[model samples]
Target chain A: MISGDPLSRVLYIDLSRRKYWVEDRRDLFEKYLGGTGVAIELLKEECPKGADPLGPENPIIFAIGPLNGVFPLASKTVAMFKSPHTGNLGESHAGGRSAIAIRMAGYGAIVIKGASDIPVYLSIYNDKVYFRDASALWGIRSSHTVGRIIREREGEAGYRTIMRIGRAGEKLVTFANVVTETYRHFGRLGLGAVFGSKKLKAIVISGKRTLKVSNAKAYREIYDEIYKMAVKTPAMRKYHDLGTPANVVPLNNLGALPTKNLTQARFERYENISGEKLAERFLGRRLACAHCPVGCIHLAALREPYEKEPYFYKTTMISYDYEPIYSLGSMLGIGNPEGMLKLMDVVEIYGLDAMSTGVILAWTTEAYLKGYISEKETMGLKFRWGDCETYLKAVRLIVEQPNDFYGALAKGVEYASSIYGGREFALAYGGNEMPGYHTGPAAHAGFLTGSRHSHLDSAGYSLDEQAYVKKEELTPEKVADYRNTYSTRYNKGGIHKKSSREIRQLT
Target chain B: MVKRIAVLDVDKCTGCQSCVFACTRRYGEAGVGKSAIFVRSLGGVERGFIVIVCRACKDPPCAKVCPTGALKPRRGGGVILNSEKCIGCGMCVEACPLGAIFWDEENNKPVVCTHCGYCVNYCPHEVLGLEEVSTG
Candidate 1:
């Protein structure tokens, strides 16, 4: 029954020293707010300058907003670290009980530092912390299996989130991601690789709490207003219906959907992967983040069998969003809808960043086709356009690092392109692979300056699309202003020296 | 005469969690320990949310075993807590099958829903609304 602001509490775990501690950092929460604000500061403190991105010193920071558990739309938890893939600021936002559970579990943030000598999983139940041995679960290929295992073993199934990594992370793939709740992920910047480097496997967090708020009347009023916007708004309705994949056809028509490694802006066979077509042909289920009214998560069921076995088959539920479709489908020339879904499924099972993996595969395909790398390099797999099976096989070999050429592929698109001669077509800004938008220069600018270098960093792509396609207006200044405004609002890491009382209260 | 635990529709709930914060705000704090209402996911986020609350039963086992007789039944099915009489032995907390009994360790008392319906006022989605039902 902690009183006042529970934001003051912090849970600390040491993988190297294998020690844990609790501290309070109320001042951090009071001033900077929560989520990205708190995580950046914590990252700077724990991450030594110029340290290895995959080293234990890199530090994994999960910060929840003050509004989480209290307000809607605030359920997102921000994950921050120096990305192994980009070697720069790596960040991703996730829902699905991650943020709400973290806040309610009686901690403002959970910091994992140092390295574990053996594989392990951390379970947080109420005020208790259990470091369970994870040797049996080690080397598992699918991220889904890891989540299913933890859900059954952990207490508070409905209330907990099992955040785990797959073979990609365990194998230290630079583009690996940390999967939560089987589907949602800290999907970019290689948080999964960092987890693997530390020999850490998974984290299960659950808590039932009583959070205090400031003016009960005003709180309810604001809450209702936001809730109304989410349910009744056309913006939410669009996502609810088709999810983000709805943008496929429209972006393709606008000549903004990056395709064939950005050599062509519009994917010629866009209808094959359009959101409308998917809903009509394959949409099996729609899911949402925790408490989110907009069920934008679209799952398409694809049943495929082993190439050698005629009788064996397995049904794969693949999650697809706008960026993955564009980066993996259009950009890689995966015009076949079923092929795109299979690629997406492999990416999820391997726990790699779909955008990064797609971009990397696209780079490899083009590079191999142009004779940059021949049969001597690709192990004799003819990497051709729309050859999804070879690309999927390439993804597995990238994790295994079967060839010296592919050892570099696991790094990321930017690194691969730099060594292999496709910088212009690399289509990556800030070292991380680009997301699925080619609206204009503002999108590039957002990637350039956005701390996380993400499409959502400023919604510049949306601004660019709306201007030229929606309104038929080409105002670069307005788009630039949009980027600047967002960067300032969310660019939270400041070198502020806090008083001891405040720092102790916050972390 | 509100007598039933409010049910929320996920199709209508925009994931605002207004009910949760409202419960805590009523206590003038910023943590979930004081919140009587909780909103969580069914499994993965793709599944949706389940809002757990006090059912406000007619025969609340919480009131029946109050060591200090602090948990008294209101005119409605909901129970009221007399903090002054509570010993905070947690008998009521264990007695609750709904897991709705809130313990305020700082005050050494149990927190119960008085059916004030403060959460309903904040519910923007109209997923929650007070319906007066007859208590048996």
Candidate 2:
């Protein structure tokens, strides 16, 4: 690390006292090298053992790496907290202006602690931090409206990130999420519920500081080399053209896509929601995180007319990706693109984790069909597969929590099935909803053992696919051995050639 | 012959900030504080973007407002900065209507685009280009 690099500074904000300060943590940055490594250490230091996930003792930490803002494609911000849903380690990564904004704000990591007495939002402009009352903005119907309002109130139009929750968070839904830039999210393991418990409505961060490199000539050469590879690489073209949704058809064709709560491994109507179809029909725009040349975020444009007035129309831009399409589309048996987009819009508006919400709904639908749950529990609503309107209403009910059934649904499928007698098909591992992969046993094993219970953790699905290509069987011993070797190699600071080739194939 | 950077298509910009960083990288830095060019969203990114840079006015207002004559008019348009003569008054920053005259807070000096066209190479979408202009 370069001397005088702002990456060594850590910002600490205590909402209980409305106080803030900055500390130079060169020791931590030097040892950990930032991002998840630094964040986990901070979480261990600040969070007391056995503290309640939703309590004040549980700290929310946001960290960015040294490569952020200085290099391309190193654009993710890692958020670490004790998950209210899983009661364990909660880690999520989001790509947007977040990592760049925090880096330019002159901090490598931000630790938010204690609980506010009243609803409030924090406005962090460079070194200054302001805690503004947000009581008026609480309980807003749509998270989109919250973002729009914050955008108007804040400055730094291009160099800021607004992260906020919606009614689901305010209501303390355990699977709720924190939305950033309207299209990106800290979307797993209930970060939003923790924010709700702390009475935190939102956080806006911006900065315009210059970062200097130790060796200017080497920096320029390396940057240009990476830029050329990013733009000219044939693999990157798929991401720019159709975004991650490109994986839908491939995964579905391989009989690896989890459909209808894992009862089916492939969807017959997968083509309707495939990347090619979505891009051709509704790709309204493509976006990228700051400093990343590859613009992989794709938004779909859905136009509809007023209920009674046919001529009056409005268009809504909803973002789509492989995971969301699998969870909210195939997993729920929704074949109509418009219907899936509409359902996705509702989930986004409420700031719920789409995967958990969809899985919980799938469980509830199956439970209803099996007579384990009834119309009385659902408030006289049906939970049939492919019924977008009913699912939309059910999603609202989950946040609203009108009854015990809806309340259980809000806790995630793991807890919901435990209560509703459908644990056999709950489709969750390690208290987190299953990701879109049903590739093989390794995927399930990875979900159970991965620190975050996320597929991105160990990428077991990729391993499973690689095994299939090589005509090999993936036993538990092999998976464990592979994980050990992979972690050991990563700890040594270099991924071997074979691992890199496997990664390229997976991508 | 003189050349200046032009905005080929504002809508083609993905708000990646690649060009902005490219501007600063030309000076051997890694941040945007010293960049002469900027790309801001139009209200929100959902709509589009507005790229702000020195458009090379034939009679530039920024140069006229310099108190110490630190800014000299270039042959084609815009102005060149002599840092030794600059008193860091920041009048050039305020005089520019487009807010393209960016101030380097660290150096306490104004940074202006020299129409170098270095950022044009980094724009993957061809949203920016360099073209010969008649400054009559």
Candidate 3:
């Protein structure tokens, strides 16, 4: 690490007091090397043990690594908080302008503590932090509109990163996410619920500064090498071509897609929602992170007509990935690509973590089918597989929380299943909803034991696939040991893995 | 032979800011404090990037507006700065409609594109390139 290559300033904001201060935490950055290292330490310091996840005490920490503005592919913002969903270590990562914007703003880590009394948004431009009133922007229908309104209001365009939540977050839905840069997110582990608890509606960060490199020539050489690798590598090409939704067909064919509450791993009508089909039909745009050249963020153009007028139509740009397609498409047994996109749109609009929302809805659909839940519990709406219209209604009910069952459903599948008696098909591992993969036993075991209890925590699905390919017999202890060693080595090396989100929970 | 940094295709620009970083890197920096080129989103990224660089204009207005004769019309369409003569006035910045002249706050000088074409190499999408323009 170059001396002062990544900024070591930590910005501490107390929402309760509406006071802010800066600390030169060079020691923390030096010891941990930023990102998860710095964030975990900050979380430990600010978040009390056994603190209420939605209380005023829980701290939200965002940190970036040294490679943030200096290199390609180091574009992740690690968000750590006490998870309302899992009630433990809440860690999630998002790639957009989040890390770059934060790093450029000259901070290795930002610690936001205490809860505010009213709705507000934090606008951090260079060295100044402004607490703006967001009373009017509070109850917007779509998170996209919130982003648009803030984007216009802030007027930073390309320089700023806007992170906000939708109605799900305002209502404190446990699996709600913080959407950043429109498409990207601090997606998993209920970061939005934490934001809701703090009454922080949005955060806009922008900055410009010149960083010194120990060796400029060597830095250029290394940057070129990484940039070349990113564009040329076939694995990265996969991301660029069709985005993550490309995995739909292959995972479905392999019986690893995790469809319909895991009753089947393969979707019968997988082609309709496959990456090839979606790109061929509805792909509207592709976007990249600040430093990354591989433009992988794919948005689908979903055009629908107004109910009153058949000729008038509106086209919505909906972002899609493998996890969402697996959860909302196959997991919900929806064959129509448009149907899947509509569900995804609602999830984004509500700022719900699509994976969790899908899994919870899948569980709800199965519970309804099995007579474990009835129309009374579903608020007189029958949830059938592939019926996105009914699922959309359920999502609205969840955010609205009209009754006890809907309120429980808003918490998460695990809590809802425990209350409603569908633990067997709830499809939650360690209190959090399961990811899209059903590759093997290690997948489940890793979810059960991993630090964050997330697929990205250990990437047991990758290990399972690797083991199957090598024909190796693996024990539970072996998987745990492998996870431990990988985490330790990568944590020290500062090597980030997209498959495992290795930056988050290395400790 | 007058070389100009021409934007070949704005649509292909990914707004990765590789060009921005590369331009600043020429002055021995790793970030975007002093870059002659600017790439901003046209509202959102879906509309594509606005690659604002020195268009190598004929009869450059920036050179005319400089009070201290710091900026002189180069062989190409843009202006070359003599840092020693610069008074750090705001005239040239307002003169250019493209906003291609980036201010170096630390040095108290205007950092204008000299058409070095270092950024063209860094742009993976081939959105920018150097072209020999007629010095009319």
Candidate 4:
């Protein structure tokens, strides 16, 4: 620790005024160790008590940890803001080039405040920053194209991170996400929508600055030890082999897959979307964040044919994990890889929250089936299970906010159901949609009290599973500890075998 | 028989900065941020990362451009800067297209790769490794 690392510095960028300045919050970094700890303080300082999440008052803060550039699995950057979706604490963690780029750019954190009158993207190079024109990129349907263009023009290749929003974000969908490094994201609670509200579409950071370490010799020894542990350890092996999709079967076997929006806890079609099946059927490649030995992100090879030319075929590589399967597969009762991949791709294109999007679509389907909504509300497209085309259309409509019904759905399951008639299985907590877990009351309670309303908050979902596995009763006190730990997010490195997500819990 | 080259692969990297810290820690005894090797993310994280250090080019451009001959390529791999002979003229920074060389503003001298391969061991993703490569 550099007692006061130069990164003890925080840069504030105001979009409304198109001005920027640096703040040396040495006190915050020294106390918090960066990331979530710093982000919470930044949020407190930047967001007004009664500020609208989508208003100019909301601030977006990005923070990386002390161990970030210096250690493995410490590559995650914590993003904090007042969520446009939840109107409370919005935090997300993403790996890829974000942490390293931010660190190398020589700052502990970057806080973005106010809204821009025109669309702009911030480019930070060594000792200088530029807000470039992003007018042409405002309506691009494909997030991939935005990345390709930015990568071609960016600085410090392999040393920069380009973060941008897709059409869903530009459209101001409450659940829109910002995509970075093709596969990583600040993926929850409408950070992208906030970006859209500010007329800010993207952020590109680059640097090659050096950092000082406290003990080089001991650092080398510890580095080697962790490297060997990463390669051989079971905790990381599961992530390396099958990635997060490994959860599909185990959760199913436990009768906790959240099939059809929790109409049932387990999905009978589990084998079709199982991690093993996906690895065998479509796993094309695997990749990891910078410096992490465990390549946990899995990409699937989705081979599709030309609709007009039956013989013509094109293969696309799509990233998949347990979350997508839960949100897009069983949650919607679709197990076919083709439909799942297409639906996932569309969700990515629109920049919507895949989990929230899937759960909302599922609720809409159930609502329509129960006659809560009619043809007039659906805008003629029947909300059906396992239909990729309609599901993709629904995701787009959410981005477009085509009607009042879809507009409410975009708000989230709980809010959407309040107007449309289905709170019993609305599948949301703290105004955010539920993750793909329904093990017991603890999972639900975790969402209700979990600061970010994220499944990883306290991993109370695992508590539900643990109780069932041990065949013992869980007292309310035990559950409260789990919820409190989740609320404080202060567990001292206890990520374990049962819930791998405990390792990557975002603030 | 001491053969070493920093081995980097595109496949196994997770874009983590463990190696960056390890490199910095090597100099951390005095302070942090003094490591020879640097690892950062390239573009968005999903696109992957860029790990920067001495590649130990067969005919080193950095050494050739140094007016003081401060940069010297060692046998094992990479160039080590001679603090005694060095003027902090940033010619090597401009000359080396890979941009691996670093001039510590605080130290007022040019810094390049020492090629101890300590950073390789720090890379948990196996993105960095020291292999034997002979150019003789």
Q: Report the number of the highest-lDDT candidate.
A: 2
User: In model 4, how many backbone clashes occur?
Assistant: 34
What digit string (tens of lDDT, one per residue) describes model 4 on residues B88-113? 87898898887777657567766676
- Candidate 3, superposed: residue stretches over 4 Å from native: A1-6, A471-507
Interface RMSD values, listed in order for every candidate:
4.3, 1.1, 1.5, 4.5
Model 4 misplaced regions, further than 4 Å: A221-225, A309-313, A475-478, A481-507, B6-25, B29-66, B71-80, B88-114, B123-129, B133-136
- Candidate 2, residues A217-288, lDDT tens digits: the string is 999999988999989876477678877787777677667878888789989889999999999999988777
Kindly give the stretch of ten consecutive residues in candidate 2 chain A with the minimal lDDT sum.
A488-497
TM-score head-to-head 1 vs 3, winner: 3
| Fnat for each predicted structure, in order | 0.42, 0.70, 0.56, 0.47
Which is the winner by DockQ between candidate 2 and candidate 3? 2
Ranking by lDDT: 2, 3, 4, 1
What overall lDDT goes with each candidate model?
0.76, 0.88, 0.84, 0.77
lDDT of 3 by residue, A283-309 (tens): 887778887888888888888899998
Number of the top-ranking candidate, with TM-score as the measure: 2
Q: Is candidate 3 or candidate 4 better by TM-score?
A: 3
Error of 1 at A8 (Å): 3.5
TM-score of each: 0.82, 0.95, 0.94, 0.88
TM-score, chain B, model 3, is 0.96
TM-score of 2: 0.95
